[model samples]
Target chain A: MSTYDPNVAPKVSNKPIIWSLFAAGGTVTALLTPVLVLLFALAVPLGILPAEMFSYARMESLLASPLIRLVVFGILFLSLWHTAHRMRITVHDFGLRSDGAAVFVFYGLAAIATIVLAVALI
Target chain B: MSTKTSILPVVGSHHRTLEVEVLRYDPDKDDKPYYQTYQVPCEEEWVILDVINYIKDNLDRTLSYRWSCHMAVCGSCGMMVNGEPTLTCASFVRDMPAKIRVEPLENFPVARDLIVDMDSFVEKLSSVKPYIIAADERTVEDGTFTQLPAQLADYMSYTHCINCLLCYAACPQVNLNEGFVGPAALALAHRYNLDSRDKGRSVREDVVASNAGIWECSFVGACSEVCPKHVDPAAAIQQIKIAATGDYFINFLMPWKKSKNTDEASSGGGK
Candidate 1:
């Protein structure tokens, strides 16, 4: 007798959705994180680019464009989601018994941060 | 055989004494595992398994382990060497320090000294149906099946799995989820799925798509690093995930067009 029944469908996994998000987040983070760090930590502090580039008035002017706001929001949201997903996996790798509570805690922070980012952008 | 002509203790051969710590346990005699040390005189070019053989042959008759085909072909020599999954036969004594620690492969129940129970691994392997399941059966009238070089290349690397269980020891997902079909089994399934002769991908979807299957893997890539044969099981698992994702959408968008187990040949066009 066959153990699997096609009709019953051994409970299809919803992992594809989460995995796609995680993958997209990873791609975005890997591409942009180092450049962002260099710009803020080294380039700005070293005065390689004028400090006025990141001045409050200049940043506000940049944020005025919906296109720039959307790009920045996408990077922040994806990076946070990537970190949350990676942290969950890392905790499990450390041999800690992860429960539903752990998932809630990790992803809840990302969700809250995303909502806050959205409000600020608006 | 003349003792003088034998390879054993050839004159003027260099030997260095190594202190080897081996993990030991007897189910009936001890409640917990313990390490036992033996000073072994090792040849300059001997591998770890050779050192273990020296211990068994000269130092202690009671020491237990499994090994065959002193080369890396047989996966039976897999054990923890210096807290890393390795085939003892591939670890040269010259590359190691004076002291060596050997233990059973981690995340598996130790059956005895250096040997872990493999029943669960065998079950997982079988669950994936590691053999080729052709859509149509060929009779005696049909001669030998031929395949293109490209088709052979499609799955040649995955065929190198010697069932060493090193990947299982290295995999964090395998350590966490008992039901997760470990790296080797999943890679083997992928290997068969890639084969032009096989037709059991739909049948295998049940286990590979389940929560206990590919979903459990978090893409740690540890399995590929520890594999002696460079099977790259992590890559195979990811490929399975991509295929499974495609299957999910295909099933959702066009349920009527979903191919049945027997109708697999009609769908596989490239073969």
Candidate 2:
């Protein structure tokens, strides 16, 4: 019969929206890396900063700090999610011909990355 | 003596068969739309439009649809094929299973069976001033005007639009808002404004300022996906948004300058 029913709603996918979030996260992460580098370049070199700033101890200590921890966690989480989203789209765009397997692999990687990052940070 | 050559049955007569269900509506007769199915013999290479044409020519002469340039260039045969906005000429019948559903383009008011009222699209096309407005109209007579290839590339892809309106069908924003100028027209506007020889910045002022223009597009990318011509109207609209934003500021700073340039150019025999 007629496929042109008014009630037939168009299907909307979450992939593009998720990818957009990933792009935004990637942009922020990119900006944050430079800002972090600049902050260290300007602030740490001065005698006013802690001498441990150059050592692994400083890195661990910064990771333990609440503000730095929060920022790092957010960046790691968003970037991993973004990577997963983009990887899925890349698979689709390349015509992998296995939607189920592609989804499984992408989400699996994302979940594993999220868990690893979260556990390490927390 | 003449030798009679016997012709064998047509090639691919037994490969596959498709049940095509087409939307039928006669404005002069039927107030409500309905569907009629026809069993069509098709080869692997036969497209959905071919089946429809066969049904029209054989099964029912009363049945109506639209198509031209079966190779897909004319863009006159866009419709919903199996719930997707597709160019009928390009959609192969073999791609579907046992059944195929064909209907008029979505998000447009159906005037009849497979025909939709295109007045709104035409009006929007006109609103964009889809034409070149040369900076020096008289310079053309003197053969002083020419555009570089790179400059032409800026809007070259946008000009390839065949007025398919598939972008409009795929755009949810257009479906939600009837007032929206949709993607095709905005893309056309972008094409003209990007022309190096064109000086129609003012012509597009209202369109860009309107709620229906580029502001309505949410960049769903569906429009580009369904476009058979690879027009990428969504990208054109996005680039136009950037241009509009820049023009908003530039015009504020030099309100008199643009008008003065236009006036001087016109007075100097350039339209």
Candidate 3:
């Protein structure tokens, strides 16, 4: 065997992926909350819809709609992608090698989370 | 054949050797710095400091250097090994081939040999008020404060700094601007400020407000890269900037009320 070793390469981890997922989720939630609140206020002033109708029931119903479902899926996919990228960085920062097993595991988890979220929304 | 007994040669008989050139400076005798060379035997496990020690012990007893703890701790043996800021004790000589160069830590006045004056580093450390301050001072009868694990995790990594000046040596900003507090000191300051039990925001006002504070860091990130402890001085400075920006807004809105209240309290006490 040659003296040169391939095992010395760095590895990535899952923590950064998890952190990025949470950060993206929080940011979207923050932005959407204010915009949704403002839209509800405007709807009441415009008299196109009743203010009280914008409740939990309306939100659940909206999620069941195809258009809303598509938006939700887009957000979830973006958040998961951001998370996976971040996790790779976090793993590398801790001096872990980016071995095939680590990459497989991280990508697998991100894929699973995204699929699960999409199914639930559907 | 019967007259001579068979003997085996040493396994490392053909091992490589290197010529190491080290910069020498003496304030008392030498008008300027000069280079000295030594031929050292190379082994995979040998670090630069090991070669220096060998040269000092066997070649020349008069040659001076500084070292402690041999490991990466104590931060006493930081020097430029082959133009890189490195802990001499931990830098392996075998990594370099044929030639090696060594010099004292940069961004400081060289006192003699490989030692640099550390007065500037100490002064910067003191400038940041690197300690916790409670909003209310408690008497001796009061018990010690407590903190949660999550709170401790915020600043725990920064506390690992062994005061190695490697970050300062690597930081070009510190080199250009002597007034800047540098990386290690700022990281330590962040350590205290981030403590959940510490209510010392008021004390850090002047430090963060000063031009020498976190503003001097241009996010070159060389400090974090050269840091042996992985303290991430760049991250600490960024977090401080976030807090300072928030504080600026709060001060602008409600400055007069607090100032007037303090003035009234002091005047009443004087009466």
Candidate 4:
């Protein structure tokens, strides 16, 4: 058991890990999100690509590679973490008090989504 | 018969009446603060401070506020003009609407009419040791510390802070957290830290790297926008954050190669 000492320096916040993830996710989204949106939403529906090319079997086969699975997980997990952190800060900026409930709701959702997506990919 | 036409003066070229609303309070007399309006006959080019002086000199001698060196260099005339923090000496009457609301700077306790208590601000500014700290003692017999043009340019932008404290009024985080070191003080700390001649980074780190220091700032960016001297205190705070983050990780990874003052800073006392 440790007693409280007023003289000790305040514990440094461990925000760098979440901040780094947010930065990486932001970079990934900036470079890849628009292209992904164009391909799946615009190109597929506008007859620019044959529908058979994006069939279920073909998509499953494309994602079956170990390298592709790793990339998918990286993008999905990092983006969720980024959005969670962003929403938490945004809520605080909008004059809402940040508390344990808000933290649990936002970061907890990101944690759960990461676990579920990891299992599905496996 | 030719009739002589009567000449009339132009409408707005002469003086105009400005409805100036000032928040007035006296700790000795009033139970709470209240707004007092004065109809000021203002010239087109007159600034808000001139109008306040007019009220003090003529209408009500009891009106109180701080101002000197009617120019913006003094930095004593900061107030809330029309819901925005501004230097009364720099805010022109011509640019404002006919009716203007003037109040004490936000996030500070009002001492009088428009004068806010600045003891906390002074304390914070001093805590960072906002001055040059050399590793070794220097003598006048030694030549003056000379700096190259490029080196001087590195921290020149942050040296423009006049301490008007408009950034403090604009920062929401400061309003929320009373102990947050605020903008001008942190920026001045960063300014000294960036100086080529100053080796006081280790000494100043105790305050700037403290939890109540740069780490508390959430990058509102309003401080930079409202800065009359274009000091960009927000940018200074961000740069300090990067440095602090690097220091945090470096200290964690290489504990044996730690810098001096690490033990002192760990004691949670300001030098």
Candidate 5:
């Protein structure tokens, strides 16, 4: 019996919506992550950068600018989404087949974090 | 047959006897497949296919496998040569370790020994509608479909998929997701979709743009790596993903401004 049916469709997936975010997030993470790591983790910790360069008031001052806030928001937003997607794939790679749960949990956290970040920015 | 003219780069100088462990299964008899080792006196120029051929001809008459056209063209001789999915014809025996292990291509049901059941593969292939879809059928009198060299180049590499299933064997997505439309089929779909003469891209999008189609592919790029013909199926899938994303936004934003070139294709396409 012929089992192949191209016309047969299951529930239409909204994966593209999420995948677009994932891809954009990946690009942002790849580009900005290393520089951010060097500045935050290496230079700041090593005292190569003056501690005040990354101190709370300096960060607040940077965030006070609308443009700076948006750029920082964009970075955090994309990076969070990217990390969530990577977590999903990593979970699957580790032989956990429960994609539904992973998506719900990881993307759920990402959504919450993004909302929190957005509200904090405002 | 010594010193035969060949297009393959000459590799391995001297001959040696190799221990080849070929996976064997007889569905009518055995419950599970098992390795049956053979001491193959492999020639320096011989590939893994030749080793298997020697085993079939001399060592074990019961050995079953599929292969034709020993020069990588037929694409039927794909197997796990030392745990790596490869075209046995292109992989020299000299390149394999002394203790070689050969098995059916991974992520497939074994029909026999090295011949995996291709029923699902065939079904998926048919689902994609591999041939060019021209709304206006061209007769012999109308002459051949003329394509620009650029248009040809757009999809020429993908046309090289002989359905060897090596990409499938290598792809983790294919193994994890059974519903995935897979690399080779999606690449072939892209081939037709890119063809200037083919107007069926909109129609094909029903299957190509589905979640199981391009979205299921995480762009592991293993498909591109294992491809004998240098077909970058991963890139093709990524290209489709970008198009599908655009389609998603376009459909939501300005639903009226829909055209095949600059705009809409259904994201409902799937496996």
Candidate 6:
């Protein structure tokens, strides 16, 4: 009680890094995921495009390039990270206080999935 | 030759009796706070504050609260009207239902009936050093500094915070974290930090950039909605997040540039 200075500031935390990634992931998912969904899921089935517009052969041709493979992987990685961070925040908002456990579990899943996807792509 | 128009109730034409339920507590008398109802004869054009005054005058003298400057400028009449933080002076009695529930602002200790203890709020306000801190003190002989209208416009809107604390009540982050500097204070901090004449961004950054500061805010945006003055503390906090992120990267890549300046905020350089 004697030495408590409320104004005495602590060192800046490392949350900026996490927040930056979360923000980037949020933007990437928001801008690209809807288009990806519309093209890959709804467009062909709803008769907006032909049935064989996104055939396995066409998919193979598109993924033939390493650059396109890297771009797809990058989007998937960011979207996964975004979902991981969102889940953690949503859990906290739902009145659960186990932030440490949530971070470990959520971010651990994202990291494990990223590695698995990377190896499969290889 | 006065041409002012009066909106007072003519005779008994526009009189409505309202059952106002107010949360009451007496520290010396009661162990816990409870509701006390007042049957108030509300006028046609009376705001919520006028209804409280009517109760105080005609119904209950013991009902205590804070008010001054009958306008919203005083910011003393902030309370929860139907679970929303409201400036009673600005909210019309006609807008509410027949039954009104009034309570002290949330996230603060109740001092008395409809009055909250503002000690913690005052402490938080001062922690940000809400003032222009220049590199050197200038005497009267130094004359006045000139600021362009464009520069003034940058931080003009933020200067309108009346310390009503509606933002504090509306924000869930404040309710959860006592250490986190609430909206009004952080908005004020940003107000000063944006001042071109100020040079103490580094001094303020120790507290402002901490975990309990703007980083604690998750951009729920409740503060912006509840702000009566439209000061937009949420926006201020988010802007600070961007600047702090820049500072974080700058500090990481070049530790020598740790001392941040107000003028060179790396904040896109304009309003």
TM-score of each: 0.84, 0.66, 0.62, 0.83, 0.87, 0.91
Give the C-alpha miss distance for residue B205 in model 5, angstroms: 2.0
Q: Native-vs-model 3 lDDT?
A: 0.70
Candidate 3 clash pair list: A10-A97, A10-A98, A11-A96, A11-A97, A11-A98, A13-A91, A16-A86, A16-A87, A17-A83, A17-A87
* Candidate 2: C-alpha lDDT: 0.73
Top model number, TM-score? 6
| Model 3: CA > 4 A from native | A1-122, B1-15, B257-271
Give the Å error, residue B65, model 4. 0.5
Best of the two (2, 3) by DockQ: 2
Better of 2 and 6 by DockQ: 6
Regarding DockQ, does 3 or 5 come out ahead? 5
Candidate 4 stretches with Cα past 4 Å from truth are A1-12, A26-65, A120-122, B1-13, B139-142, B260-271
DockQ of each: 0.25, 0.04, 0.02, 0.23, 0.32, 0.38
| lDDT tens digits by residue: candidate 1, B163-259 | 9999999987877776677799899988988887888887887777777778788889999999999999999999888777777767778888567
Model 1 chain A lowest lDDT segment of ten = A1-10
- Candidate 1 segments exceeding 4 Å error: A1-10, A51-70, A116-122, B1-12, B135-146, B257-269
Give the top-scoring candidate (DockQ). 6
Write the residue-wise lDDT of candidate 3 on A11-104 in tens digits: 1112222343545665776777687677776766797777667778878888878889989887877667666655654564444655355658
Model 6's CAPRI class is: acceptable
Candidate 5 deviant stretches above 4 angstroms: A1-7, A10-12, A41-55, B1-14, B135-144, B257-271
Model 3: per-residue Cα lDDT over B37-70, one tens digit each: 8887765567788788878888878777778899
| Cand. 3 TM to true fold | 0.62
Specify the CAPRI tier of model 1.
acceptable
Interface RMSD of each: 6.1, 12.8, 19.1, 6.6, 5.4, 5.0
Candidate 5, B1-271: lDDT as tens digits: 5686976755654488999888999999999999888898877788889889989899899989899999989999999887789999999876778999999999999999999987777777777788877756789999877766766776688799899999999999878876787898888988877766766665666677766677777778999999999889999889878876776676668767544433223212211
Q: Which candidate model has the greater DockQ, 1 or 5? A: 5
Clashing pairs in 5: B206-B269, B210-B269
lDDT pick, better of 3 and 5: 5
